[model samples]
Target: MASMARNPLPGTIRKDGRRAFYVYLSPPLIRELKKAALDEERPAYELVEEAVEALLKSRRIARPATDGVA
Candidate 1:
């Protein structure tokens, strides 16, 4: 019998201490996002991250480089 690999426990901190959360989007938006992700051959999360960073910059909010620590 082969041993199976173990999955990370819920809420476990991985790279950059990223946490998973849910967001609600309209069906049309979801479709568009999925299509775009497929067309670009990139993960949806990367697109979301870019959009979020742009929004923060536009709002004059500073993004900390290391988990909000100076």
Candidate 2:
């Protein structure tokens, strides 16, 4: 079976030099994200970033880069 960890989406840096990462989500998760973003009146990217940070902090997800090192 293919490992989920190896199924990351391709990402690239934006023209403005901001790093962007892509994550493929299921239809349900996409709907939840859109609803949450709208309810909070914030961009979906911002909510995504917050969720990612929380996950990293809780050790639920491992970041590509370790502290002060990539």
Q: For model 1, how does the per-residue alpha-carbon lDDT over 1-70 read when each residue is reduced to its tens digit?
A: 1232245456555577765656999999989998999999998988888899888776655645566643
After superposing candidate 2 on the true structure, give the runs of residues whose Cα lies further than 4 Å from its correct spot.
1-17, 60-70
**Candidate 2: residue 8 lDDT (0-100):** 38
Clashing pairs in model 1, backbone N/Cα/C closer than 3 A:
none
User: How does candidate 1 score on lDDT?
Assistant: 0.75
lDDT of 2 at 3: 62
lDDT of 2 by residue, 1-70 (tens): 3564465334545566556566799999999999999999998988988987887777734555567653
Candidate 2: worst 10 consecutive residues by lDDT? 1-10
lDDT of 2 at 49: 84
- What are the RMSD figures for all models against the true structure? 8.7, 7.4
